[model samples]
Target chain A: MEQPEVAVAAGDTSDPLTGLRAVSSLRVLVESYELRQVEAALRAGMSWQEIADALGVTRQAVHKKYARRIDPTIAVPRRNRT
Target chain B: MSRLTDAVVLSQQIVVTATEEAYRVGHAELELDDLLVALTAVGGPAGDVLRSLGVTVDRARSAVAQVHADRLARAGVPAPPAQPRTLPRTGGGLPWSPRADRVLTAGQWDLRLVDDRRILRDLVREPSGFVAEVLAVLGLDAEGVLTALDAWVPTATAPSGALFSPDPRPWRTVTRRGWVPAAPAEVWSLVTDPARRTAWDPWYSAVEERADGVLAATLVGEAEGAKPVPPGFERQEVVPVAREEGRLVEWELRRPDRPGGAPVQRLAVALTPSGGGTRVDLTVRWLGVGGWRAVVGLLLRPVARLAWGQMLLAKHAGIARALR
Candidate 1:
């Protein structure tokens, strides 16, 4: 087993801004991953309402955004109020 | 004019030992583990400090070896490529890399005297350095070492002589802690939200969130009937450089440009969750001081501390009230 490196690099904390940049980048990646998962669910025969419930969003809201991409022939639905 | 003369022979020995260990591992750089092993072998004030903190030479050696073994296993490197002793120790005198040089330099500056313990203190503070690797295996961090160092009082005589005692510099750190009757998340929200801050914000009059998580704020000086802003000082940018939601927030305040450069003051607020409330620790540090200001600060440390305490008290009171 390889021992994990836990030491701070020589000048890692010299600049405080570096950590902030890292967090920001990580957040962007997280958002991208969430989007990818949602798209995959939609492509896997999951209904907009089901995806919306899993995401804590309204069915109509999910349909309005992803409906055309999920099923172009289906008519757009009005957003549902929370 | 060699400041390294205090226990120069001991220092040389430690360096050689560290180099030998680094060579044994086939690592060209003399890292913190090597230093730890060397320090352990020397067995002095630094060694005592390490022992007090539950660290030993054997422990350090084992930790370093474990890390190397893990790395080799992961990388599929051949086991013990015929020993590092076969290779020439790169760089005479243990050959400190720039990072090691910086660590030693920092130790000298911080301790104001070069000694084993001082070096140990500096090396332990390097979280991403080799010491950090060892510390991780030991279930410790830089902060843990710092806490231990603080609690430790030197007993044995320092090799640097009587004049080598650590002296107080002009620098001062003021840490004020307050309790807010809310969860850490709730308190963090109030603290970060400018709208909610209006009720108790003693530091900034206006705080606008800038691009990339920066905050532009007009700093508020003394309260009503207080002394005016000192001459040559102006309201400057305050950047929230690091933040851990509901936990830690570190900000930097840029000073007005001067000859050398603008000084930057650091402020960090840590929120620790307590019983149905949050404990907030706010620490302010003055960075970049030299020339006349340092001399003045040194002279007025007591007065400055009192003023800082008052300001922090007021701020804490305001926070408590707002939370209520």
Candidate 2:
């Protein structure tokens, strides 16, 4: 049996769906590192309001877009699922 | 090798006991219909009680049941007992005495719940951030594990002897690495789903259902060249401890080869939100198989956890991506 195409190319990290491709796996790894820049900006232990001002978005939008997603399933009530 | 196996077996037992007590003690026993009847019948104590709590009697009762079932399934009881085997219900047995052949000694832990905000702090914004974080902690390659950790989230908490205590057993536990994810929800979706467990877990062979809402999972060692799989092992998950926007997943382990041809393990995952990401807490315990010494176990845990954490990191990444 042949292995399925695990990647389009061996050396680079590019996804057809995401449109933008990283030059290499290392680049892909570092791409997300920049998100830490946003993270650092948000919380210097700063308030979401303060963070929102820095990002130039309303606090609510920031909370919605940037806030963590909880396990909504966590709020699901357990019962006899008929 | 036998010592390593024993460590896995013993630590799992203690986790099971402490985890069950956490959920069972805090739950309310009333069913939904019972609450409805109380709601209509009173300006009485029950109705007043409901109002005081700021929940309609019906909503309160239903919510309680939901939490109860979530807690049970999250406990991981569904994974092991999906098939009929001799494993006991509570967990695997462990003895403190070396000659007696038990796992971790003593029960009752100092475990507590992780507040919501604290967990959120560990989150990542990337599609596979939970998986990525898991890889970071597992010390896996950044590329492979980041996908998994990017979606990581806490499933449960069992107050291990994480801190110093007079009793050596709880205090001296094996190290379970920090589990993170790009998105905590994605991790919970992958782990809590009975079908997806085998995709990431190294120990389980396949996952199946034994009865309504009950799950059974077969366990097999995937190590290279390890032939003659140990006696039959199973995984079971009971009601989940908590499954909301954040998940507290409860799960247990079953090993048939041990003394009773059965031993046990347990786990919990919890999530907290921070900034644009989440903080996750993961707990695993060894139920049966006795005579665990902290010093002896400590020397082994770092290496063992690193190995398993790598596997989990990979799984978390792949599954989280799939979830997306």
* TM-score of every model versus the real structure: 0.35, 0.32
Q: Per-residue lDDT of B293-321 in model 1, one digit per residue for the tens?
A: 87887798888776775566556545554
Residue lDDT tens for model 2, B1-324: 243442342233223322222122221111122222223122222223223334342343344344333332332212111111121111211212121111112221312211211111222223323322322333334443224333444343333222111222442133232323235666666677878766645455667756665566655543321234644433434433334444455554444334354334455555544222233444554533455554555677777566655444333333322332
Q: lDDT for each of the candidates?
A: 0.56, 0.36
Q: Which candidate number maximizes DockQ?
A: 2
Model 1, which residues run further than 4 Å from truth?
A1-82, B1-171, B221-227, B230-234, B256-262
Docking class of 2: incorrect
How high is the lDDT of residue B130 in model 2? 30
Compared with the true structure, model 2 gives a TM-score of: 0.32
Best-fitting candidate, scored by TM-score:
1
